[model samples]
Target: MSPARGGWVILLSVVLAMLLSVVQLPQGTPDWLAWLRPNWLLLVVFYWVMALPHRLGLITAWLIGLFADVLHGEALGVNAFGLAGITYVTWSLYERLRMYTRAQQALLVLVLATLLELVLLAAQLVTLGLSFEWMGLVQTLVTAVMTALFWPPVFLVLRWLRRHLKVV
Candidate 1:
């Protein structure tokens, strides 16, 4: 398909990621499984920002983040800021990221996810007056690790779609 026709794939993937990010496991699911949930939107935005740096910019990221905040029922602008900040970093390093091996990319994803989590956590603590707990912190680490673990397969699928659809 032409780039013009295929561009919507980006939007579609992002929407799906947003939905998946908030999707809860079935009833009676273990709490540990919840901690294993990766931030799907973060992974998708990272992929697209890296794959199409020229097309996906900070504004688009901010919009996506705003919607994410709504979806997650967080204080408005909290996730928006985090996503935009991460998106900016990814956009700045797109060339280098593209050249990195999958392992390296996953490592970076871990670091990036950790940073984004910290930002969002800090914001929530401030806005919601939430107390910090060690378990919460541990969950953050688990989430980052889980997100990083998911990076390879997510990268492959998005890469395949980008190539298969001839999306620019």
Candidate 2:
């Protein structure tokens, strides 16, 4: 698994994940929980940070975050800062996270996913002076749950792709 090829694999995966994250319609609210949305981009970024930290570092996360901000029409640099900060935390602890079992990693992903959403919320508050909504927090929880639940399959498929394609 050469580093160069690994970079390409990560780039392609991130692109696909970003597309999925941004192109979805809002599902109607459920009686129990309605703010739930899939955090596809966060999951992919988390995976790459843990699996190939050297290739997709904080800069990449920040750039993607900015792109997400543009695509979603949020405040500029709101998601960029959040994603970069989380990426920094993930990268700093990448080695330790890489050693965790799949279940543990999934738990960690949930925590990080929640944190990412919160960071974006805070950024929005500070930048635009937007009123904080409890629904925003609830949405974060939903995102965390969805990210955690879907992580195993995404991780397994990515791991297999990396191993089979000779990507690091």
Candidate 3:
């Protein structure tokens, strides 16, 4: 499919992921419970970057990352930098990544998701002087694991959408 024809599907998926990224649990939920919220935007961008590097990848991710910054009302460039890092790594290694099975990809997703969280944590520390005493570290790891575990279902669904919608 032409980029013009198929691009809306890609955009729609990204928008949905963005919306999911900000979903808040009910009030009085434990703070640690927040760690269970998968990085929906990260997973979606990873899928698109892996599946169609030539069409929508790094730049798109960076833009979405900027949006993430606004969405979270954080300092500019934090999410942008984190997302750019993910996109660049994925773009560079996508060929090899495509050869791996779903389980293997989930393992790598764990790593990438961890790295993204670390970047965010580092930015927060540098910009706002937070997370110096490992306060967020555990939650970061938990979130990464959650994101990784979510990979299989996210991958299957997006792959199906790509095939059925013929997103190129």
Candidate 4:
């Protein structure tokens, strides 16, 4: 595929991921259940960075993170910083990431997600001066587990998309 077409396809996927990220849970859902929400944008970004490291890098991640910040109504640059951090790590390790088994990749995803959450929390602490909540750690663990569980399907589907669409 032409680079332009491939770039658009990747951007569309990122946009969809952003939409998924902001989707609201049903009313009256338990708080714990809410904490289990996966960071869809991060998962999608991870896939693209792994799949097409040349095309999707820190800039793509930063842009998506800015959009996520707006979509989720968080402080500007919070998600940008966290997502950029993850993307950088993914890009640096793309070859190794691709070689790993799915299960191993999931563990890496969990670690990356935890780090992302910590970055966001630290940003909140600095910007909003919000006292740290221990519950935030639980939320991070829940999000990590959910991200790990969701990774295989996401990886497969994105792999299919890359193949079928001929995304370079």
| Maximum-TM-score candidate | 1
The whole-model C-alpha lDDT of candidate 2 against the native structure comes to: 0.81
Give the 10-residue window scoring lowest on summed lDDT in candidate 3: 1-10
Residue pairs that clash (backbone atoms under 3 angstroms), model 4? none
Task: Give the lowest summed-lDDT range of ten residues in model 2.
Answer: 29-38
RMSD of 2: 2.8
* Clash count for each candidate, listed in order shown: 0, 0, 0, 0
Stretches off by above 4 angstroms in model 1 are 1-5
Question: What ranking emerges by TM-score with the best candidate at the front?
Answer: 1, 3, 4, 2
lDDT tens digits, residue span 73-161, model 1: 88889888888988999998999999999999999999999998888778878888989988878878888999999999999999999
Error of 3 at 151 (Å): 0.4
Q: TM-score of predicted model 1?
A: 0.94
Per-residue alpha-carbon lDDT of model 3 for 20-128, expressed as tens digits?
8888888998987776899998899899999989877667788999999999887899898888899999999899999999999999999999999988877878888
| lDDT of each residue in 101-138, candidate 4, tens digit only | 99999999999988887777777677887888888777
Q: All candidates' lDDT scores?
A: 0.89, 0.81, 0.89, 0.85
Off by over 4 Å in 2: 1-3, 25-34, 126-129
Using lDDT as the yardstick, the better of models 3 and 4 is: 3
Models 1 onward score TM values of 0.94, 0.84, 0.91, 0.90
Cα lDDT for residue 57, model 2? 77
